[model samples]
Target: MDKQEQALGLLQAAVESMGGQVRPGQQEMVKHVVEALDEERHLLVQAGTGTGKSMGYLIPALAYAQTSPKPVIVSTATLALQSQIVGRDVPRLLESLKGKLSRPMDVSLLKGRSNYLCQYKLGGGYPDEDEGALFSMDEKPPASGTVYSPLANEVMKLREWAEHTETGDRDELVPGVSDKAWRQVSVSAMECLGSQKCPMADECFSEMARARASEADVVITNHALLAVSAFEGLNVLPDFDVAIIDEAHELQDRVTSSVAGALSARMVLTAAGGAKRHCAVNVDELTKAAHRLEKSLTGIPTGLMDKGLPEEMGIALNDIVEQSRLVLALTKPEANAPADGGRQTARSQLQAIMDDAIRMLETEERREVLYTTRPREFVDGRGYVESDPGTPATLNVAPLSVAGKLREGLFDGRTVVLTSATLAIGAQFDSVAGSLGLMGAGAPSWEGVDVGSPFDYPKQGILYVAKHLPKPGRQLSAETLDEIEELITASGGGALVLFTSKRSAEEAAEILRPRLDAEILCQGEGSMKSLVEQFAADRDSCLFGTMTLWQGVDVPGDSCRLVIIDKIPFPRPDDPISKARTEDIARHGGNGFMQVSATHAAIRLAQGAGRLIRSVNDKGVVAVLDSRMATARYGTFLKGSLPPMWPTVDKKTILGVLKRLKP
Candidate 1:
């Protein structure tokens, strides 16, 4: 049989094995994926919900891996989807295809180094300067601040577990400890002393994971690690010739984060502390630079630093660069000097600070974007203008455009197939393709295929736009809250209210709880999993949340009959990255708002509205309280990105329909 036929046959078997019917979209997706892999071409597939997209690609990936000497890599955006693929889908597919292939396929879930335990760190061979106090087995805090210190109680528990665990994976541990505690036992990829230098080189958990992935037929990882490996040139995963990106839309953001660098007062202090003993010059100079950096950062308003930093901040940054440089030059170890893990680590830390501190003022190369961020707000969501600026502002630098880098580093050299339910925004893949470096002038040749969803959207759901409500602003609107209350009452409390901001969600829940009959559960009041489970279990309960609730949440059946959006989920106006990118686009004679801001809002709006329907039997109403969705000229573009739900604007009609939809 041809590859297409073979893939389809495998998919059919997988569907039957999972007790599911074969979907036409899934069949089409499998054929396209197989062709893409065989031809070594770039392909973008928009496979809507219920398309069985995972099986569609996996069946072909299995076939390709068997034929090629290289393993296939699959990257996902969320932990939930990764878990679904690793914990459920891949196993079922393998079970169906058992004995049908030349040899059994091995699927290994490979995570970044930090996810696995570092034996060197656990063995007390090296401790980060910030964590030198760790590895003590003392049960109690140091009495009267004496020098006699012992290992933390939590660290002792981890050591006990380390002695018997096989995989040495943090996820395998139950009743997980805090990040502060975990950092003591584990090391990041950069922090660890390599096998050649480390005494515990044998049987390293991270190394063991890489060895498994290297031998496996398929390797699965998240976008974060994929970005680091692909763009940052980090060896976070096993080498592969082909990649299947499940959530293709999140690629740009993930890559940006992986390559981005930040400099802060905390980083300065930490670097200085680490380099003290190793510094040939007086470490006091570096400490003085840290304080100078903090003073310069004080009272600097936080936003995009497109034009430049304040004169004082610039001078302070220059001082940091020089001081770090001088220290590095003076602290070089002799060529044949004994391998001291501590000294080696200190130099690496200092070098990173110097590089980023220089990048903060990088203006000649327009390829990077620079911004400043204010310290996090107090728990009350308020901040005061203190003279000291308690916490210094952080300066960040990120690639302004990752397209060229991705094109050269990823898409150009490999066969890549990107699939997602929302890949085609407004029925076109041009936007997402551009972001992934598969489109535009001189970009790699690529094709896009749209495999429509199985569910009949027009019949399964309604898109209700409240055009008369007041526009969202600095303050929450009473009319919007009134509309929400009426909808919850009419729908009999099966509502998922999505707000643009956490503060707004809290305010809405606070105002609605006493007036509504249903048990109102706010997002932060409980864990998201527990809140979502409770909401799904009780038909008369309402769960209100922000961005976290927009995607990766599935609530099928009558329990989620109403989805209320407080507003169009746009990038925050003051967002530094957004401002910088928009300005850059505008400078290049482009419509910045349309390309950057509106597209962002449309993608998120689609994701939020998607929460209303999860299965073929699901029937619900997506109520968008923002009038702009119906009245603005860009409204058509935004609406086109969503599922083709039955559209309406009459409030009375929607309310009557909700009343009828009551469980």
Candidate 2:
């Protein structure tokens, strides 16, 4: 048999050895995915959860990279998946595929600089020399006699360990740290000095990662870095012939987010003042610009600012932009000066931001709009931009289509493979394909295939919709709460009660806390990792969280036996970006609700359901509490977005099924 056939046989063998039953459709999907990759054409594969998708794609990608010298980059949307690939899958697969491939294969994980601790910061060159005050670790003693005394002591130990760290990744640290703690140790891309200029040149974590990436046959990274390299041209990632975007559905959002930069008045002021401490600048103009920018941004509304671009606001921001430009221009870099490095970096960052603002102001698309609002209003002149707590406060403008620009910038130069469990939200790929500007001509033709899941969704999970409940646009009803209590009791304590709003999550947690015996864990209680760890440690823990919990979280096995969505994950009625995108859809004579709101809800619903079955032995009930999921005409559309779970409105059956599973 040929290499493709042989590869498929190996994949089947691997799946069976892992005790995973492959469906006929899933088998076909594996065949087609390999075929598409071999052809060097783009393929959007939707492999629902339970499909051995990681293996299906990995086998082909490794096979292709084995014979060819060019490396393949696997991009995931979450750090969890990235770790799984690098730490677990790659190593295990390498052992399994030994002597099978033509040559030895190497794998590496690449991340943004911030993911790695800066040896300089660990050593004490932080811009703030008052390290003990800035970093609390030095201020306090480690809980007696423990190796980790002050927090700084922990950082020091980590730095010492860095000398022997081959991967130079913080994820490999024995005890993972919080993002806040990580920030104290690591430096962002904009903040990092290149190898030649950096004092820690030979031992830089970022440089080590880069060198490893260059030498490896396969590289793993997240969408943000890939998007940054592709769109912003940062040259952060090593050269690769092809990239497989695992959670392809989230790519556009990731790309848009990377290209879009935001600066708060406080951030600007802090940066300017910080720069003045070292580098020379027109401090007065910088201060004035910060105040003016703050005032101008304050006038813009939060959520979606679809209202046509305001001329007065535009004029006001223009003046501030000009002032910023001048201040940045005057702060010229001096050769080899200590302050020169800081000055040049600050200049580039500010200019890049100003350029983005200029482009936003200049874009002719009528649908494109801008807004300004304070996130928080302090009693004393301190305020921040009011972005959605659940979503980034963003100025989203789909340039009618992104295809032309995407083709010109990211696609034409290389081979791209977009794979996800739910890329095509409505059976038709147009909604997704259109968003990416992939709807046009023979310009890189596209083919789509569905890789069926291993679990018999019809038997493994039940879709419970509270059909008697009212619509969710208004305040959630009392009946919704009642149903939630019943479901929680039915599922016992092993459940993720998903909510569309933090308020709902809080309210539910309050009501359910009094009613259920399980340990109640809420989102605001701690970091996501902390919450996940708590939930895993005790199967009787119920987590109530908002939008973020819907997608990024993954709790396999008995720990997560019931996934409860409190409502249809709808786009907020007042969301500025969604509102504008909806309008744009309507302007094209399409159903805006279906195109925007419903599509968004559909993706989230699928994501929420996906939290249920994360492994071969996993099983659970996905209870979407919104009645619209069953009664409304659009309910079918939303249901289509979910995994093909067995449908059941019968509460008794669902409760029985959930009870039979582990709590």
The candidate maximizing lDDT is: 1
lDDT of 1 by residue, 496-605 (tens): 99999877888888888989999999988987889999999999999999888998578899999999999988798888877888888899998889888898888888
Candidate 2 lDDT: 0.72
Q: Looking at model 2, how many pairs of residues clash?
A: 11
lDDT of 1: 0.83
lDDT values, one for every candidate: 0.83, 0.72
Per TM-score, the best of the predicted structures is 1
For residue 385, what is the lDDT in candidate 2?
29
Estimate, for each residue in 1-663, the C-alpha lDDT of model 2 and write its tens digit.
Answer: 876797787676666656666566566666776777777777788888766577777887887777766678899987878998888887877776667777888888898888887777666555532335235445344576655435545555565666687766887887765555566677777667667567777877788888888888889999888877766667888777787889888877676666554555665666567567656655676667666656655535565455544665465446557766776767755556452344545665666546655655665642244443335432322222244443223333334334455666666756777788888766777777766656767466778767666667777777888776777655557888888777777767888888888777876787678887888999988988899889978887889898889886778878889888888878777765567667777887989888778888888788888999887677788887777888899999888888777888888887788778754
Off by over 4 Å in 1: 128-135, 138-151, 277-281, 333-341, 379-391
Q: Give the TM-score of candidate 2.
A: 0.87
- Please state every model's RMSD to the true fold in angstroms: 3.1, 4.6
Query: Per-candidate TM vs. native?
Result: 0.94, 0.87
